[model samples]
Target: MQYDFDKIILRNGTNAIKWDGLDKTFGAADILPMWIADMDFEAPQPVIDAVVNRAQHGIYGYTEKPESFYSSISNWMKKRHGWQIDNKWIEVSAGVVPAISLSILSYSEPGDKILLQSPVYYPFFSAIESNNRVMVNNQLIYENHQYKIDFNDLESKLKTGVKVIILCNPHNPVGRVWSREELEKIGELCIRYNVIIVSDEIHSDLIFGKHTHIPIASISEELAERTVTCMAPSKTFNIAGLYTSAVIISDDTLRGEFKNTMNRLNAEAKNLFGIIALEAAYTYGEEWLEQALPYLEGNLDFLVDYFITKIPNIKVSKPQGTYLAWLDCKELGMNQKDLVDFFIHKA
Candidate 1:
């Protein structure tokens, strides 16, 4: 079955933030908004069917993540990334951001320093500071048209008594999938420093050609204990609105603490549709992903070539994973306001 990557689904009336909310967000309805993270294409038919089946039942009541939910997700992880996860390790959550906040709350204390690689997802900052924790940056080194971790700076910060290191594998904005060596180096540092690692692997499934997504915990049992891994089909299936994700913590103690935090927040129940959609996605969306990936690679290639030939000034980061691209506009040399205006008004 060939999937339609080029088919344009009308989302303008669907309250999609990427489309319908553009007027409210950017103050212009006609800017061809591309700032949001979701794709313009529809989710897989299996996912649609799952949600529709649940919807047709016509009873929206309290829902829970069944054992099958964990089994389905576990199977998907094993098959997709070769990471074996037990059902006990999976904690259902509304989304990755909430899971991060919960992990931050569970593992670290207020005013305690936590580390992040900067120019990351903006919510990471709020997840730390809003919880009254200090945000530390072990900034990534950007040179030769790619990004690399500054391990020395990371170690220096860890030595200063950082409690938790929030990691974004297949990093956002700058989308280089962290190499195994890089992951191990950071893991070793965290272990030595007795710091917890909250790795956000939300975009793990969307990896491009030749790049693999490695679950941090899968590196070793010890590292797994020290890590809180967040993942979801939200990004992969374009189901963010459904708000379901898994926080995989293989360590018994860490899993307990994170679950305790979720219980405290009263977030244990997932919506009926999200539960069905997640199961449907993991069980039957493999074929859809097989088709979608090549289309995504083509889109990325086109963007790269267009920028190089037509714009020549703006540089777009070539992502090894995820559909989102980071545009490097440093060469434009305009102030932030001017840059915003350039895209919103001029470009």
Candidate 2:
């Protein structure tokens, strides 16, 4: 079946966080709403069909996650990323953000330092601060039009007794698919410091070109023991509203801690529809994802060409993964506030 990604559907009345709050988020309703991470396209027919089929049943009761859901997730991981994830290691959460919050609570104590690479997904900051933990930034070194981890800085931060490192693998905004060598270096640093790594691989499947996402936990047995890998079909299948995400903890001790935290907070159960949508997406949404990546790449290319040829003052660092385009408007000779105003007016 042919996918129509270019067909922009009307989302104004759907209570979409992207479209509904345009004026509130950007200070104007006229701006093109590209700032949010979710896509503009509808999810695959298979996903929609599954949700609709479940809705038809009309039995909204407390539900248990089936064995098929776990199997689907494991199969998808092995097939797409060459990662062998056992069913026993998986923990369900409402979303990755919640999982991050829970990880902070489970693994670290108050006043402990949690390391993050910036300028990252803004929520990483909140996840740290909201839990009464100190946020330490090992800010990425931006050089040669790409973002690279500063290992020396990371080591320094680790030495200061940071308990955890939250990584945005195939990172957001300033997109850079972390290489194997980079992942290894990070793994080494975390191991050396005895710090836990929370690898958010939410965008792992959204990669473009020859770029590949490496799960930090899958780096090695020792790294796996220290890493908590968070993944979901939400971003890939455009199903964020479903609130289904998987947290893979390879180590039994860490997994037990995470599970205990979730159980204590009563956050372990999956949403009924979330399970249905997740299973369908992972099992049948592969071809849809495969097709979507090329269209997104085209969109990135179009945006780059448009910015270069037409909007010469604005520079977009071409993304390695994810649909988000980090636009550099410093050349517009305007301050950050002015640039935002200009885009709001122009968009």
Candidate 3:
């Protein structure tokens, strides 16, 4: 079935964080919100159907994760990325950011150093700092309108006894889908320095054109052992409100420790609707995603053309993956606040 992406449903009164917070967030009530990561489109019918079917049952209670839940995720990983993951390696979490915070608690001590590439998903900074861990910014070098990792800087930071690195695979904001060679370089550094890598592959399914997302753990058995790959159908299927995600730890020992941490914190349970939505998205949302990517790419193209033709001073880094277009408004001779104000006023 053809999905209708052009129909702009009014989200203003729905209490959407993206829509409702425009005034509070950017200090303007009238700004068009292209800021949040969630799409303006509706979720696929299968996902909606699954959640509705679960609601029809009417008995919402504490739930145990079913074997099918694990199987759906495992199968999807294999089918989508050609990566083999056993059901035993899966850990359920409410979301990727929560899983990362728990990983900080599980693997690193307070005052231990964690590495992040910026300007990344802002939560990466929050996850480390809020957990009482030190954050090391291995900031990406922006050149030629694309962001590249500064390996020399990363090596220097890793040498300082960093304990963990939060990697954004198909990174947010800057939108660089890490190449195998790039991931191998990162893997090499982490392996050598004995740093635990938390590879958040939440945007793995949203890539465009020849760009492909390589799971950092999939590089090698050694790397997989040191990696905790956080993934979700939420971003892929536009179901962030579902709050379901998978934390894949291939190393049995690491998985055990992570599970122990979850158990200690009592955060292992999955919501009933979350479980059904996740299963449906992984099992049947592929075709919808296949269609959605091109439309999003079209949106990216439109933004590019619009900027070049109408707003030439505004520079947008063409996203390699993910729906977010990182617009460099610095050249417009305005401070960050001024740029935000400009967008708000214009929108």
Candidate 4:
């Protein structure tokens, strides 16, 4: 059950976007890819074995998700996060980013205002703007070397006919595992403003230290009814290429609309290997994750301490969850262009 997370794996020749496509993405092949969210470790052995076993059957066809797929998700949510969900609440998606677009299509119209916390995951910006929706920002406040939700700004934005707000629980880039109190405040505002919450909980499994990731919907039944929570085994198991994710919607009408969007987009068909890997990951990858978390935590600690000791000008925001870190390089006295050059050409 002990996973060797310290073992370095070569991903260069593989079609991994994080490694193989770096030259095309960053304009230099030599640049280290610390940008993409996918991890550098190998997936859980059980997941690999399950996919290999499935591939050995020697038939690739349109695959239907088995009952085990639904059960694995439902059970994993209940056991890991203490969030009880019915199998019926689960809907299929290839990825969380795509699911976000689907939710925007399902619940809001073109030109409808959608809110986001600034400095969030970049794709969130694209999901709203590309769909022709008005993008609104309620930027997070940075104080005392940490990030905090600007609840006042959030509430003010929500009041402006904002039809949807995409919340990043255990927020990306900034790395705040939202507390229950913060989630409740967001829930209360959404309820008051009649805005739907599309919560991206993809990083829920990778929390660190004393911080617990509370699924925003789990706080209250009222919150659950309006929240469309997107999650996947992809990030937890480093299977992002497999492209399997789930959208859990408790409200019957909301679920139906999301399903309708999926059907309209012809996106309900699950990937053959993705399904096998997902089921294996949720059912048997916990021990692998239990090991990976400590490794990740150790990595975070090293990064933070290294910055303090060696790279004094670059302050690191020690995350409460997820492997991603937010680095502040303002004290280095570089402009945006200089910073890009420093990381790409010098660092």
Candidate 5:
């Protein structure tokens, strides 16, 4: 336990969206902001050291991602997730959303269809519709307070000519880590229908008890060919402001298409500090993560207990992955506005 998670870090005036943007976004300076994904803690010291070292070097120049960058990613994937990746398979983007947006541009024509699972990361809707692609949601099945993929519905959507499907591994909001079998089903479906899979796996590293995140690409070579697996240290290491993410496309043609799209917009290169911070994180942040996860799980346990004991009316779904807790606000009988008001004003 080298790092402390219980200490509340004051973030006011730090320009942090979670803390500083509260007044601007919610029209009040006093509401405790918990809507965003970023954590309230500081990054591990090694990541801080790397960024500070880069800053102190005083040469802020355009830089290319070196071979070590690829090595760190490859090694991390191999050691942590049991997936071996070639350096050639990796590509850089500012963030996962940007990578998905680029995936939309690279793989599909305007007016084509893209598929997603809902209630998913809300940005998937924007990434599809913003790029003039039709958004198709294969609504998830929520039974007994757990989310399961509706394979029949997903297959039905693919039949409508979905060119791409964005997967949120260890899914956002509702945190269910897709099992290997689940990924196999998804991969097989994409192969059968020729739908390219764009997996937004930014939350992959934050998995919880008895849940493992199998990269949809790692399920098989064919799946890898059709899948663009997007990941970042930003979520795991709390560095989203750095704007760094990795997009892995195993097929040569798909990789070339993605690289071309990035080149056209000069988005291939990563931010200088992001580059250093990412390498440091993947290489040295494992120890910090081992400690951070239990703290997160403990936090969830605390919330569940507190709710049952003190606020018996509220129900929360304990997450299998990610720090997010999806609360069932239904018992309060609040509409959308009422829900927002209750969180902001009532409790």
Candidate 6:
């Protein structure tokens, strides 16, 4: 069945932050709100059906992650990425950001150094620092309109007694799906330095064209022992509001510590609707994704071509995965503040 990708749905007054809360968020209600990562499109029909069915039952009580939840996650991982994971490895969390913060709290002390690739998802900075951990930057190298890991800098930073390194697998803001070779180099360094890796693989399912997302833990047994992978149906199925995500930890010790943290913080309880939506999404959302991906690719193509013809100065760094397009606006001769104002106020 073909999904309607061209249909425009009115999200205003739906409590959607991207549409309804625009005035509060961006100081203008009329401005098109494209800041949040949430998709404008509705989630899969099956997901909607499941959520609505659950709501119709009337009692919204505390929910638990059932055996089927783990099965859905494990099966989806294997089917989509060729990564086979056991049910025990999956731990349900409220969201990816919360999982990251919990992992930071669980694995590292307040003064310990936590590493991140610079220009990553902004929340990562807060996740590390807000926990009183020092944030270290192993910046990515941008060359030829593509982003590459500065392995030398990464290794050097790791050597300085870093306790944890947060990795954005298909990096955000700059979307290069890290190749196996790149992941291997990173894995080797983490192993050598005894650094725990918290990999945010939230965008793992949104690959474009021939690009493949290799779960860093799926690389090797050694890597899996130290890696905590954060994944969710939220990004894939446009269900971010559900706040349901999974943190896959193969290591028993790490899993125990992370779960302990969750329990201590009273955050282990799963959202009822989120659980229903997640299971439905994982079980039946693939057809929707299959259609959505090509539509997104077409959108990307249009943006690239449009930039070439109309906005040549704002070069587009075409992504290998995810729907985000990174625009390089250095050629526009505007400083950061002016450029932001240009897009926010003047454009």
The ten-residue window of minimal lDDT in model 4 covers 1-10
- In candidate 1, what are the lDDT values of residues 1-347, reduced to their tens digit? 68888897788788888888878987889988788898887899999988888899998988767789899999999999899999999998989999999999999899999899988999999999999999999998989989999998899899999999999997997998998999999999999999999999999999987889998889999899899999999989888898989889888999999988999989764778889999999999999999998899899999999999998889987799988888988899999999998898888
Better of 4 and 5 by lDDT: 4
TM-score for candidate 6 = 0.98
| Quality of model 6 by C-alpha lDDT | 0.92
Report lDDT (Cα) of residue 150, candidate 5.
97
After TM-score superposition, the amount by which residue 18's alpha carbon in candidate 6 deviates from its true location, in angstroms, is 0.7
Please give the lDDT score at residue 188 for candidate 1: 98
Model 4 residue-pair collision total: 0
How badly does each model clash, as a count of residue pairs? 0, 0, 0, 0, 0, 0
Cα lDDT for residue 283, candidate 1: 96
Which segments of candidate 5 are over 4 A away from where they belong?
A: none
Looking at model 3, residue 319 earns an lDDT score of: 89
lDDT, model 1: 0.91
Give the range where candidate 3 is weakest over 10 consecutive residues by summed lDDT. 338-347
Residue runs of model 6 more than 4 Å from their true location after superposition: none
lDDT of each: 0.91, 0.90, 0.91, 0.93, 0.89, 0.92
Q: Against the hidden true structure, what lDDT does model 2 obtain?
A: 0.90
Q: Write the per-residue lDDT of candidate 6 for residues 64-129, one digit (tens) a residue.
A: 678998999999999999999999999988899999999999999989999999788999999988
Please give the distance, in angstroms, between residue 173's alpha carbon in candidate 5 and its true position after superposition. 0.9
Error of 4 at 325 (Å): 0.7
